[model samples]
Target: MMNNFSLLLLSLVTVTGVSATWPSDWGFGGWGFGAWAGRLSPSQERQDEVHDVEILKAVVTSMAEWERSRRDTTRVKRADGSVCYSNVGCFMGSAPFSYLGVLPAPPAEVGTSFHFFSPREPHRARSLSFEEIVVPAADALQDAVVVGPEFVPLQQDQPQQQSVRGRRDNAASDDRSTTTTSSDVAKSTTPSSTISSSSSTEQVVPSSDGSISLTASSLDGSGLLEAALNLGFNASLPTKVIVHGFGSKCSLIWVHEMKSALMAVEDCNVICVDWEPGASLPNYVKAAANTRLVGKQVALLLRKLRTQYGLDPRNVHLIGFSLGAHVAGFAGAETPGLSRITGLDPAGPLFEAQEAEARLDASDAGFVDVIHSNGANLIMGGLGSRQPMGDVDFYPNGGAEQKGCSNLLLGAVSDISFLWSSSEDDLRSLCNHRRAYKFFTDSVSPRCPFPAFPCESYEQFLEGECFNCGSQRQCGNMGYYSDRSPARGPLYLITRDNEPFCAHQFFLRVENTPSPAEPLATHGRFEVILASKELNESFVLTDKDDEVMETGDSLYRLVVAHPLMEELTSAQLVYTAYSGWISSGLSSWTVDKISVTDAFGKSMSFCKKGMILSSGVPLLVPLFPGDCNPPRAPGGLDIAMGPSISINNELPSNASGEELSASNVNRTASPAPERPTENRNKTGIDINISLHLVTTAPTSV
Candidate 1:
């Protein structure tokens, strides 16, 4: 009977013009079966129902053939006769045969049941019971089974039963016990698996869509807080919940790093939300749709915490990355008075132009701060939204291309491979997109304050036009301490390419003096190289256009340096002239003086009248006291050298100046020290000024 039914379905598929291979045009509401299902007449719909039944029968009789038929795609090959493995291509290729069903029933499994429903009427499902039917390994692709637990709608007036499963932790206790509720009967029949917490016997069961497991950590050093279901959550401490994005699990290294940083800074409860089952790979659209359900699950968890442990919603902070950001938004929306939600580059594809309720927005929490690291358009290979979705949106380095992500184009292509595998190495392609969380994590225990200024655009901020904190002190911090600022709009800042991205910002001004011997306007840019005891870094002071610097003109720029140098032993100037049609031999310019102001408002000026700067040559000038005179006072009298700005000062107590490498820099948050007012000798200050350009490799954490 099954063989005949399978043959009949095959004949009908041919008559209906259904290709033997998976259809490429199928999607959530795209063409193919869904479009045809909507237009079918009553009689045709009945025929479709028959086809569905026959397909189920085929599942029982010819399971191997069913799997093989989906793989057979000779009829759907492209013009080049090659299979398309792109996300859309692979998704559409396998979506048609995908079904919502269960594994075949085992013999004598009396209580085993499965849900059956047409794709067109997923919500109108019915359960089927089978006895003594031996099912083979037919669903090779795992497409027939639902990704998570089946959603059982609550019946009116019926109590909702929830089952909690626990395991025995060998180290914590020797008690071997199992607890079960009425809902265990339903859980036993489902295909969901269990994930055990590392420090406790608590088992997180993700049986249905939106289901999540939470692992709690606190500052007591016990590692786990024991509570209802052994969740071990402390109600007195502030709670921070971290949610991972698509294709990521809660066990990610960055998540743990952030958790450690949060705990090191304050005594709080850190919870990592594990939603890997619903956010699995190969079907991004499905994962995207699952976020709504996962968000509701998170809201449910929060409510449980509040009821069981008295955790205040206002004391809870949600930090989510990519799609998880929107998930946090949904959870925050459901649980009113959420204290804060920090979105680390929210996913852009389906949520870019979505309404406030659909994505992370200001109304989701009391304060919504977002860091946009890759905000370019989707077609242009940007995974993050460019739109401002939070109350205080920060666009670091313009928020599209990061300084160290040179293989952005290659990374975009590699992102497509995520449809198959979710390897950590694949993250190298998403360097810019992942930087949002890295920046946030670093800000938790920063070496220096990650200050960002209010600005209309990054261009205006880099020009040093928006350095002031304004009358309201509207400047904001970039990461963990963002709420300290009163700013309520977009903020801009610059960051380094590697670890310890936070830097001390300085506003530099170079004044050109008119030299009668060589006074022709020069089309060139000046590069300022700052030298200290530990490191030497260079930055361009002029725009990329190489704007002609006329005599007596002053150029201003905003530059950043890490491992905050307190005093400078020497400064080097490199001038590069743009090659033009006309040639001028050995072009030189005269600089009257150079001035620098640190973030603390301390200013210093180095005077060297008639200092000649030649193109393509490095000019070193002494910055120590007695080697160069200070800027003259307004009345031409020499200014007293009281509390002059110093560079190349001593390293912090935690850092070793001689052995400090980029990787070993201490990043623990600390207050900036007061500048030294004591005078220093000009001699014995070893200044190494090598024009070595440093490039940092892209890293995941």
Candidate 2:
């Protein structure tokens, strides 16, 4: 009876519109049988249902055949006109799979369950190492069968349903007894046979004309290649792979900012890897573990891209942060000879103590540069690694505590701040950890250059010993435009605490001449003011408590972090003595010589001609007499002593005898002529003479 019914149905389908030959475009959404058959069996409902089910089954079979055909087309013929399947191919399409460079996964038995907890919240999950979190996830990825959209957890689901907080408390104890077996670890390390044939989990993102969507149930090299081709990614141009850390996603503000910055700088392929499914937050242990697997997947995609498109690996640059930094390292290792790898404070925790194979190391790429913005001890809540992870590791502000993070944390704690807000205070807490990427983005084409002095430590850099980049000492540029030095080690530099952190750094030496009669009398704060056509800047020459400048000539090195980008003109040196038991408050000192050096190591000196300075007044000292055509002194005077300025024998004093006012001092410089075309420096450096005493009081030290 069934055979008779099937034959009748088949005959009806054949007579109606069913073609003997299938259509080439018969894919997942294509069902020409339905379109061709209009109103089939309107009088019989049961027959119609049976016919519909059978037709759907036929459509599924056709779709499978179409996939097979498409895959078969990837196999090209050899010189003999026979299809070839080699382990190593000019293109990886339909090539025989080999486990030449497959990544190792963590070990976990089937049916092992896992739970997660927030790092901020009190939880026993902390007691469980990273191995516990990632091993299970890796095992699931390598072995678990996906029946539908969702991943069937390899471990059995826990019977007791508890709140998030309760689960957090019991996570460690619940799974402590069931230790991972040795054989399970061995099996997990060696991926299952199914893994090599398995597809990756991914989503495609395009720049123009289409919304981002996941095309298939799995991610793999072929899908990635097709997506790149369809999205109009130019294989000839350099490709920048930006990978985000664990617990973060591709849509991060910094990631978008970097993409935009790179695009603005130059046209290139910017592929932002979004492994959110594997690296989801609050499950940080799981995310951390998945990094290796995701990295391997990325490597495979890159390998296919290179083989098929002839995209040079030398043009490939990997930029990753925290856990993603290690991901870049893994990819670089898997695909040898990558052009560059920039790690923005690679994650600490388990990675800190891991071997080179397990964590980011210097040998991953041709040129590996690292920025350590937050390397505070992990136990104290810091998130980045303290150990150097790249060939040239830049430590900004000692790479321990960042400039403003301390204050932000203090404010949050004092105010009982909201958990999530757009407040500046809230944003700054993450500022230090994320500043490495921010600095790099700005450096792509910054207005002001970020000049860094190479020193053994930041302390030495601050002390002014490492001011010169020449004379056997080297200098490194900070951020995206960094020029790696042959002499590699920890490079130190200081930056502003906020955005637009780049500043002009200058090292100046103040030569203080002692009073001939009372040499040991200078004991107070000394202020030096430098003026330019655009801005006025000052530095404290003498410390309030220091007595070193009392007996003889003292050489003080001052590091000026000038926020303004202007050429320096004239300077005024003032000294104020502290009121002591023996020393008078109105005592004076003599300025002999002043020398200044810039980032280029060019030194410029101005002889002060022994100008005596009183506590109540500022002593104006001329820098370049050649540029100072007609000095604008108290009486419109033009006095040039080769390279010196005359000093007033006596100065007017206020009631306190120590409060120096601009009115009390006779200070002036030659007013710059209106756009003197011929007199500008040949080098275009605006080092002209245009100084005037600022009436505003100097900030107290």
Candidate 3:
């Protein structure tokens, strides 16, 4: 049975994505035998039975346009010995809404590709880290069978079942107490497995019209999140972490922007969670209590991520604007899984409350570094209220309000808020996913250049080059001011007045009928400033080169997640075998590192760490070698890499899906489900996975 499943899966690997002519049925809706035949049964009935009430329909809708295009495809050779194909079919949401990465088993030979970006794999930075989170195809990618944490009592189906944290801290107590065991408790509440009873093992049977089907439980109630069909269907791994907003006038700007940034950097899988608005608090006391509760929920999600996905327990980052700041902070403080949180002007209203818990600070949560624009965040112990996972936190100009609502969904435009005020369309505070990303990953936008240096200090920092304002053509620095500095201090950016003055210039909202025919005036101002952590204790842990940065130093270091350098390009830095360097005095450090600061500078030590340098630019992501990054599954057969603006451009809408379809468009492989008669009283859990794979198929065309 396993072999059958593996063979069925192997048929889909168009490793040689040759662009030769294909068959007309390629990527079109088709079927297989056995469970496959049952798949087509009551297609409409399944639709009617599938109960989906997720209010975040826009998320689904956002993905729908792309989903509808997925289709099955097949390869065919012509009479002339060449090959060609065709696309057809439609795509529908598979089963299991949450984190599909672990579901609907695929053959071990295949896995889907997720796009992403990271401090370990930035787009154009100089320094890079070894951060690639990949779950093995099926076998290793087992869905977390969550029961419950010891702290909270889950409302299980069992009327009287209970779970409590045991007082015993000893290993013997942990093993014998049975208090931590969720299996018995969960079984008391719900049935063992949600899968159907008849399925022994998935066996793909061919059907007429050259299509396949499978028998599995799925999201729509029709099937489980089935792993694969021959349809050259495609999947994306969301590499970016998005803080999705849940309130009206509460835009998820940052989520979208971060998505774009991650896409620009590499193929990544995106995890979308709610950024709910705080319901109105009648009083300070109530508000404070509510804030605590909100924080708790955030904490729960963090743990879920850790248990559900192999999200680096340390690398999870949060970027929240407006009210999300509170939520991010609450989650960061409350959850053990979370490491970083970026509060873009966390609302000041909540801080007004008399409640102590409501007053968020670095210490409140485990996050080490803190950042704030205005004095909105409370400062305690010289640490910031706006804690981030790393030791370094940036406070761009505009105080706490600097780009307050950076949750701007628009990609490049999201970067604008940091350098300038936003337009009316985004006036209600948007999320700046790009800048937020830069906070932890040093993923600065090309538009918003880093402050450049010319005094033999830092150069080629991209954008904001050091220039002699004294020289006519050189003084147009976007973030720099007319002032030049030779001191070891903040790097200032100067903005100039506009020519045909933007009628809607920030600080001035001009209406129509302006009679002024006068010369276009300049209205530039200092936008952002970069300073060494040495300037302030919050930014402390600043060290010079050859300082022999040890374990206690902030784990922070500059990195270029991705390199544009086509060939070998190594930064001139020496990293001790036991530790990664904080800075390389050599001018050669050029992998896109904005800077690397530690969360506990001189406080914590790493057991074993090594240096990772970008050896190549690796422009075409998902299929390239990066700073110790494993390659991503390539796009489906016959497709080359393209910067598809529309999701369909990257993935297959049901129609485009047909372009990559196969005989098993609906065929599925059912992992061995523990039988009620056999394992009704099972002991340890048995795990299996169906991995949908995209291989090294080449585009023959």
The TM-score, computed over Cα atoms with residue i paired to residue i, of candidate 1 is 0.57
Give a tens-digit lDDT track for model 2, residues 282-316: 43444555565556556655655676456788998
Off by over 4 Å in 1: 1-231, 407-428, 470-473, 515-519, 523-525, 532-535, 542-549, 567-570, 576-587, 614-701
Instruction: For residue 6, give model 2's deviation from the true position in Å.
Output: 60
249: Cα error in model 2, Å: 2.6
Evaluate residue 496 in candidate 3 and report its C-alpha lDDT on the 0 to 100 scale. Answer: 14
- How does each model score on lDDT? 0.53, 0.49, 0.25
Cα error of candidate 3 at position 556, Å: 34
Tens-place lDDT per residue, model 1, 566-626, is 6655567777676766643337776766666655444545554445777767766544322
Task: State every prediction's TM-score relative to the real structure.
Answer: 0.57, 0.58, 0.30
* lDDT (10s digit) by residue, model 3, range 1-701: 54543343244222111111112222111211101112223332122112111211222232333333322112332111100000000001111111111111111111111122233222211110001111111111122222223322222221221111110011122123313333232112111111112222344443454333332211112121122223221132322234422232111222333433433333444333332223221122222223333443444434433443434535565555434455465556544434455454444432433233333444433343333333332210010123222233334332233333433322332233332443434322222212222232222222222221122222222122332222222211111111122222222221111110001101100011111244221111101011121220011112432343222122231212111111221112222112234433222111111121111111111010112222211111111111121112236222222122243445422112322222212222222211112111112222121322223221110
Better of 1 and 3 by TM-score: 1
How many residue pairs clash in model 2?
A: 5
Which candidate has the highest lDDT of all?
A: 1
Better of 2 and 3 by TM-score: 2
Screening candidate 2 with a backbone cut-off below 3 angstroms (N, C-alpha, C), the clashing residue pairs are 111-154, 111-155, 111-156, 112-155, 200-219
RMSD of each: 20.6, 22.5, 29.0
Error of 2 at 578 (Å): 5.2
